[model samples]
Target chain A: MATERTRVMGLFDTEGQTASAIRGLRNDGYTLERVHGPIPSHVVADALALPKSRVGWFTLAGGITGFFCGFLLAAFTATRWHLIVGGKPIVALVPFVIVGFEFTILFAVFGNVLGLISQARLPRFGPVTPYDPRLTGHKFGVLASCETARKNDLFRFLEAKGAEIKADEGGQP
Target chain B: MTETALTYQTVDDTVLATLRPPEKSYWIAVALLFAGILMGAGCWLYQILTGIGVGGQNNPVHWGTYLINFVFWVGIAHSGTLISAILHLFRAGWRNPIARAAETMTVFAVCTAGLYPFVHLGRVWMVYYMLPIPSQRTLWPNFTSPLMFDVVAISTYLTVSSLFWYTGMLPDLAIIRDRAKGTRRKIFAILSLGWTGEFEQWRHYTRGYLFFAALATPLVISVHSVVSWDFALGVVPGWHTTIFAPYFVAGAIHSGLAMVITLMIPLRKIFHYEQIITIGVLEMVAKTIVFTGLIVGFAYGTEVFIAWYSHNIVEMETFRWRAFGDYALEYWIMVVCNTVIPLLFLFKGVRTHLKWLFVISIFVNIGMWYERFVIIIGSVAHDFIPHTWGLYRPSLVEFGIMIGSFCLFFFLFVLFVKHLPSVSMTEIKEALPTGGGHGN
Candidate 1:
């Protein structure tokens, strides 16, 4: 039996304050719905305990694929025509390395970008829930959904930690 | 906002103000650039109707101005990545304000450079032959060819640079989105991909940006090396050299940094971003010029030394002819501009003085263009057989096209400054404190 939960938001002024509130939430076993800020901050990252991104796996996979693809494309195409220059072999392995280098980078870039967008769940349309534009400007923000009965406790919990609680956000009481 | 009063709000207000409705001067600039574009298009069309000879690339000097413009523009595109990606990897804070403009310069410069090869083709319609697609005749492009390497390298450079630029812009676009109204807001909404600065977004975005920087560092170096191979692979006397790769890379960065200074000085004044772009940042860039300039000068001396040291008569003749021949004026201009004048950056007063940096940068720009001109046409003009030796002077068509390319670059640049926040608003805000903060 699940109870309806109230969505509450907290706005913080300083990086120190943001970290403090997030730490308080963790100590009390309250999960943060989201933390938003104007820029990336290590303090907030540490507070959330986010893992190092596995995006490199994507880049590694892409590089490996690109190297083989580039080498094969050169080898297969060169075989189609018995082209040789200055007694150089038709299947010139040395020359093919240049193609491999370029493709490895290109595919790696593609993979990195794809991994970013896919992992971030980006291109999210409409307004982000519990959104505050200032979070994109000066402020740091934290949002949490909790049991309706625990709403006041969460607000008091955030306020005690120096966070300013947003009132009547989108007509929520 | 003054440098003494920097805050998060002012960062947004100052940069986004460029997006305010255009001024009379702005339109005048746009009109002038448009006229230049039209002049170039007319010349290009005339050449198309007339034939490749109209480019005035006579025999022996067949590379001509188009190839010079090709390499020149490609060289200009390099420093942007060096600044945006390399500096980021090194965690240089001074790169903050300038990186946005540098990255944008790369995308457009590459765009401008990419057109030259097609323009050089004489028959631009057959340009698809450069693609790697399966031909109707079953002939694929040569993977072994340096030109094909160029096709791959440059297109990849363009793609990577653009993605890097756009990825960095995501949070800034969201800033614009938050501040806009109605239709403009909707457009930014889509462009921003609904970014709300969530930890998840930042996590992936930062990591991806890191990899983009790491990957782009090598790509930028390789792109120009492939361009150098366009000459180095050939057995032509002056064109064949092991040093061309590093020499060209240094020269490319030299011109690229100069262009950055050339464009940014005026941009800083216009946007009233003295606080954001600060003299310290400019000095940092100028100091880099001293290092790059020294390498360029050393390469010049080393080239002469290498020619004499090798005892290769053909190569020796090429060097001798370049220094004392009919095109000696162009040769000296390259030496002075690319080498001598940039040496001024060795002094702190010159490096910090905006006007000095700007003037010297213009000279470097000229010198770099002549540098390519000297290397490409000068070398070819007097290669193996004296009987085939010939000189090139760009015809009206070539001159018009070159002028148009400059105008095209400036035109795209003007549009970029006007439409987008010329500085990174989010990055600037990251530097803000509870009070006034110093900008990077």
Candidate 2:
């Protein structure tokens, strides 16, 4: 399945050009959203006023959880098993730190992966999203949802603003 | 979002071209790697059937070639994470082209390294006993042992490194997905997790990338340190030392950087990605090798000095034996290859010259292997008990398996380069400013 386009999209060569088009679209009362670039661009993000992603919070939470879990696992298991070696303390804090440190990294990585996939709303197998391949390369792209009545005007607006407009119509969501 | 003739499509076309089906040279290389893997697998099977005795390990020198290779490969794995995560954190632009290949190498090297413990075990099937789980007999692995820490650290490092690598590949995979067709397209689509390069997707990806880099940075230091503890925790004459952690970490990065150059020089040549992986990047990597070589050399000096300074008869004797003992040849070779050769990189000409850099890298690689061997077997072979001491020469089985591990690594790498963008398209594109030269 592929994504149905409910909007008009344009491919621009650079971030500045995309920013200008987005500004022009906003002036014309079109809601500006989803600016795409080959790289993460502060210019494009600023133009669209994107929210800062909260992925870091997930990582922090995962790390804290991992620390406690790792420490407790080592401390608890040793006491539970009661297999004393070399007559050392059952809860060896210094040695347990190693396990804790490792698990912190392990769970933080897991959190990062989960955060990326969930926040990105990934693996949408239903349909291909309305997109341009060049958006991930050198071109900066913009997609603006429009009503059927305003579609022609939107295309003309994009074309007049020097965008290489493409009709992104496809599968049902 | 500005206009240029070099658009996203062009970059995609250029990088994806390298992913095309193999030419004759590629085919030959893959075949050779496959043959090496087959020979190694056969040797492993022979060893498994005939017992661990088929290998070179004996009473005194129990940890021989397999353990050395394990350390060697794990050291080789370090550069990938260092290059990818460390440099990314530092925002070093030269790291763009090198990141993907380096991370891939890390994963494959770790996989190769992980196999040795199993191979070294008397009963490979009993490997599950190493895990910390509830058992009918209530047996639990000792967490206090550095060897146990090694198992946890390496496994955690592997998981984190793989995740970091896979996360970074999504954008590139999306590019491939868009360019491919039919089954290939479907495969990439699934692998890419429906990436559309949408604003939200990129936002999450960038944040997640930063988080992964942060998480991986400490791992680069910790994993090798734990591996070092495997020896440091032991009371063996040469192996017992507090400096082992930092020294091992430094050595890991040193050898890993050399391995990266060793792989990338040939890779860029084969893929004709010279423009992307230019001499500048290679020179930068070479410079890093020089820096790391100095640290390793200092550690070596410190090791010898500590041995003598400690005034312990066994420690002093071990230090003396290292340079003038039965394995004197290997010891000197390690010093010359690891420490002395890397000194040539002090000159700009050596760092810039790919051929010279390549030669130096091969030497560093050999030196590192011998360093581990010298540290491991050298100490074990001549313990405090002269009567029990013995030398270990690897049997053909061990040699074959060692060779096979290298082959397996190359095979995976070769397959990765052919199937995916060897040079990261998104990162290289990101590096270039508006209208900048392609893949610089």
Candidate 3:
């Protein structure tokens, strides 16, 4: 049987505290596994050296797709339909622009939504280990994967930095 | 941590706590809204009791104030979603206190706006004919028609926005549920759908909320564009321009933001959310209104320029009539109110001053409504033949229904602020440096 690796999770009561702890942990060669907070904290992200989110890339793609689709709808309707009335031009680019612009915004927004969902990995119905309910109200938690031998050291460091030890539940098999 | 030392200085709490139930001012506003609703009801009743003749709808001017108000309300609905969803997507922190309230306005305004088409139909019962349903009559709604597009667009917006608004309320409802002691607790508990503030639940809720916001963002743009298409798709003189989509959208945001400021000013004062909805937030929103107003003003200018540059006789004549014809007063008022009044917001003092911003917002709303009225009635009233060119006079019923819509919007908003948590508690708490954990 393989020995299970221990992971350390530190819960802080404040964003500033979590941020500083993250920086200190990073400087000491610890890698952060995940962060759970009530809201996003850029400072914490910066400390953890997380990369620029792919959400923006997804949103941009969505927006571009929406824009083109909108343009096509308008262009096709006005030009291809041959709904000529009086002596007016069969396909007018000017009027089509409005519809095109609208579609651009529409598609871009769709991209943003889709990107967020895919990036966030939402709607997982399987049961997972529960976190402290108080985390919803005010807690900021930092989870770190560590070797079994270094677990005690990480715990001691977090405790010295005013972090409360939370559950040591392992990842789902 | 000392409980007494924590600042409980949010303006909403102070104002709401002190607001006596139904004061003279409250009664006056309510009475006015009720009167407008009743008058509209009377107009609707008369239309049902008799026919659709009471509100002047001649040959050319088939659409009247009912459609104008519908477009106007739909435009009004756009701002709330824009402010809530767009701002949220960008991670604008200031929207925390007012997003939910703004969303509520969006939902109610959309509901009111949705009614105009049915009212315009003399036989309101035939509304089902507009739906994409197969019947014994073997009639199908023309999907090509802009009106059908409106039904789809508006319905989509309403459905998505309602979901967005309700999803946002879930967490807050849970808070209320925990706080309540009696029957209210049970009601909140059920409404909360058994939300337990568990980490996994929040994880899903947040993701779900973000997804909905993203979904709602496009609907905001598409809904209004489709509304604009109702006219732009037509070959009618001034209405046939391509600029109508962006022009209409800009105008919608302009008026919508103005209405938001108008509602928030009174609400903040009434509810005492000064700390939560600070002067800074009001100023920020006012600045956005100014930017949108400027875009709308530019669009207005471009439309006039394009009309002349295109050199199309009918289009040119439409522009001429809009500027110097029968409804010149309405046009000028729109120019002055929508374009000029918002220009005052460029001043730092005006933007920061809540009272001034509030007054400006009201004027902006009034101006935008007139702009729609001018666009719809102006083009429709006068067309290719001078012989068919006529005027539209909105009867008392038309006027009543328009005012009634405003009442409906306000009534829903007022009720929402009182019962529901007006501010996003979780979001606001997150903004605090301490993550709001200091309280415990």
Candidate 4:
């Protein structure tokens, strides 16, 4: 069945009010689109049932790659031209460890950044409609897509939890 | 209102006020800094035209004021990452008010420090030779060189710190975007990359921030250690010591803490951020300085004590020259400024007294610079061979260039506070006793 999903955004003055409203909506089987606020919230995440982030895997992968790259680069350059100073070995890993450590961090940071952009769909262009500027300040915003027929029911439920309805319009799921 | 009483609105208003167009004194200061830059640049040009000899880097004292300035500036860059990254990992709430300022210092100090290598290299254009790129004969830069570690570590430090600083500022930039109008609004919106504070975005952001802090913590310690290795790997009597790594790291953080106190005091007074960056916070920074200061002092004593106890004639002679020779005055100044002076902060009266703290911080800055001078020049000037030893003093050209570096640092900082919110609004808001605290 092709049921319409309309966009709705609600603003709450306090974190307590937003947490409860989101929790209530979730318990009633409504899937939330996203919540916007000035800060991250563990309470809201719990309510939304989001999984743990996968950014660490990316960082770990990048770190391993960075270390190997640093080592190989040094080893390659070192063997390409053999010049021994003070009778020391040309391809020593002890000195390369510093290079490896530096690269490990450098790449980990890069991977972490890439994970953020990819996982979060960042650099989002165009205005995300129904957004209030106050959401960046003290206000907490709850965005959801609801069945067009029950928009009023969602509104009443949110208003019951002390939310200010900022937007109620048709939008894609 | 107290910190707990602060609402998001007041925090935004307070930080945003610092961004407003400034008084005449600001323009005057900016103009003076610009002139100082020009003078420094002019002197650098003079050096380039007249050959490197004008800087007074001679046979024994080949490493002169330029190396000292480089190490000093790099050391200045340390505590910023220590406070921002390490404290974030530890969840020390005290770092909240001043972390933004400190992180900014790291970026600018690195930028300033990066310049000296070029200045020191009379043939500045040959800098690529220091990189890993293959030369005409396809010789890669020797990775075993401590200088190689410096190249990689410092560039890495600059890149990571910049990324960390910007990522933390994203939400705060969004706050400004909403509050702004016209062109400013459009500019901030783009800078913020259209951040709307979605929960998913925040989730990824917080996790990424944790990862950055984690990566940066080790990088900070490693960078200074690498810098110390630049000297430690050498066979110079004073430079080559196993203690050099930890000793340099402690002194770096020590000088860096004093610099934070120096910058933040006037910043608070001028920007009226006393409410946000309270004197209590400054005292906490001072308290940290006490710990780092003691480490620095202990390192100084250990150096001399080890020199005497080791009974290595060269090391012993180096110490004797450092404390009682031609450069003894510089050594005493270093001890007095870095060690004895910071001890004053142990007293509450001195720590809380703004004027006293500022004056002491200035002396510490001077003292730390001289400590570098005493270490580099003192050892190099009077090394093993008696006939090759000679005293080297900095020419006026070197002093001019040094003055320019300081002006460049302050100039960047002054411009920074004006353009961006010196205090992170979102972080401050998160630190409030409100729910949904992200621990930014």
Q: Locate the minimum summed-lDDT window of 10 residues in model 3 chain B.
A: B3-12
lDDT per residue as tens, model 2, B327-373: 99999988999889999999999899989989999999999999999
lDDT of 1 by residue, B1-440 (tens): 45658777778888988899999989999999999989998999988898998888878888989999999999999999999999899988788889999999999999999989988999999998877678778888888889999998999999999999999999999888888888898888899988888898898888988999999999999999999999999999889998999999999999999999999999999988898999888999988988898999999999999999999999999999999998999999999998889888889899999999899999999999999999999888999998999988999999999889899999999999999878998777665553233222
Cα lDDT, all candidates = 0.88, 0.86, 0.73, 0.87
Error of 1 at A58 (Å): 1.5
Cα lDDT tens digits, model 3, B242-359, are 8888888989988888988988888878765666677888888888987998898899899899888998888889999999999999999999999898989899988999879988
Ranking of all predicted structures according to DockQ, beginning with the best and ending with the worst: 1, 4, 2, 3
Model 4 chain B weakest lDDT span, ten residues long = B431-440
Arrange candidates by lDDT, descending. 1, 4, 2, 3
The 10 consecutive residues of candidate 3 chain A with the worst lDDT sum are A122-131
Backbone clashes in model 2: 12
Candidate 3 C-alpha lDDT tens digits along A1-173: 87556767788876678888888787777767667654555556556555544666665686678667655655554453366667766555555554455555555555655664465553333333434444444566777766777888889889887899887663211
Model 4 TM: 0.96
For candidate 4, what is the recovered fraction of reference interface contacts? 0.74
TM values, all candidates = 0.97, 0.95, 0.76, 0.96
Candidate 4, residues A1-173, lDDT tens digits: the string is 89988777888877777889888888876768879888786666676667788888888888999999888888888898899888999988799989999999999999999888788787876767777888887788898768888888888888898888887543211
- Answer with 1 or 3, whichever has the higher lDDT: 1
Q: Pick the candidate with the highest DockQ.
A: 1
